[model samples]
Target: MATGRSTVFEDRSHAGAALGMKLSTLLPAGEYTVLGLLRGGVPIAHEVAKTLGATLGAVAVRKLGVPSNPELAFGAIAQYGPDSARHINEAIYRRALQYFGKDELESLERGTGADLLALADTFKAYCPELAGRDLLLCDDGMATGATMKAALDLVQGLAPASIRLAVPVASPETAAGLAPQVNGICQLLTPDNFTAVGAFYEDFGQVGQDQVLEMLRATQ
Candidate 1:
């Protein structure tokens, strides 16, 4: 069952811990895996992993942002093992690209090479033991959900028994959009006036590469 309600969180850690408590009471006792979407998702997943006593891993997804506003995403790419998948909002992508001229658009596409490679490396490093286990796909929050959508697509290819999306906060519309795709959902907050994911967090700092690697290493 997909359940959601509005709630406030102190920080990523607090939200993770609170969500973990709720999940503990809801999920049946069994072997489960906790896979956090890389960057911001890692911190929240760390707490969930600890609370649930599940192995932790990372799902690398890079959003293809609007050239002018990097925070707004029109598409995203997710990589795992040797495979990569992309999800694009063509309506937004077409409109957003108009801001950049031909030369700039070409340059932007070329710049994606390094990021795509890094996403592949991160996926290979963090993903293993994914088959035949109940999985929790987590993030700190979701706005447009393009990246998380990509993450979900990648994980589905791995043949997990079940996949549930767990996020600290998400807009009601985004939560509803994701509900039918996954087996279950655990969104602590579903604000109607959602502007961005960071707006709901007190300490939504960037998660560095070193921190992500260290968090994954600790689970192994």
Candidate 2:
């Protein structure tokens, strides 16, 4: 990957601890809950929950990848409670529709969405009851904020007392767009010439399923 800024973290654990310390000061005193978006978010949120002295959980959120390029996120899909919700980047989705046409777009949604849901189910465990608690949604970092926004949309259905989004770093534009959607925002770094989330960290390796499962087990 392309390295942009100076190395910010040695690894995920170190980044989490740094983020946790900042988040600790942001959280208010109350019955609070911390939820990490799988799979990278889990490790980061683990340290944040540990610092905040709160209960922890994980939510499975999959980016709705573009048909032409899977890495390009046009939106996201996630499950909250008993229902599944989809959030779309309207501009991108419309552009994709124009490119793929009606039949092709519908087919894309059917095929890619099912695959995304199956991938989500593999990582998701039993998320705790979130009603009446102050909730903090954690992520390692954010680029377009599409996936995080989808996760937030679903969690809102659970009716938490308050909801906050926290991350170690984020693109400035993405953070600004997401700010009003939640109760509060906590970002350690918002780079100017932001290329990608991994660019800010030294060890931005892919977070594995085993690591996610271990963190969820600890919460239980």
Top candidate when judged by TM-score against the true structure: 2
Model 1's alpha-carbon lDDT is 0.81
Segments in model 1 whose C-alpha atoms lie over 4 Å from true places = 1-7, 101-107
> What's the residue-level lDDT of 156 in candidate 2?
90
Q: What's the lDDT for all of these models?
A: 0.81, 0.81
Worst 10 residues of 1 by lDDT: 1-10
Question: Candidate 2 has which clashing residue pairs, if any?
Answer: none
Superposed model 2: Cα runs more than 4 Å off: 1-6, 119-124
Write candidate 1's Cα lDDT for 19-75 as tens digits: 898889989898789988887888788888988999898877788777888778877
Q: What is the lDDT of residue 52 in candidate 2?
A: 78
lDDT by residue for model 2 (35-115), tens: 888778889888888887778888877787777887678788877446577889999888887887878767777876677
How well does candidate 2 match the true structure, expressed as C-alpha RMSD?
2.8
TM-score of each: 0.89, 0.91
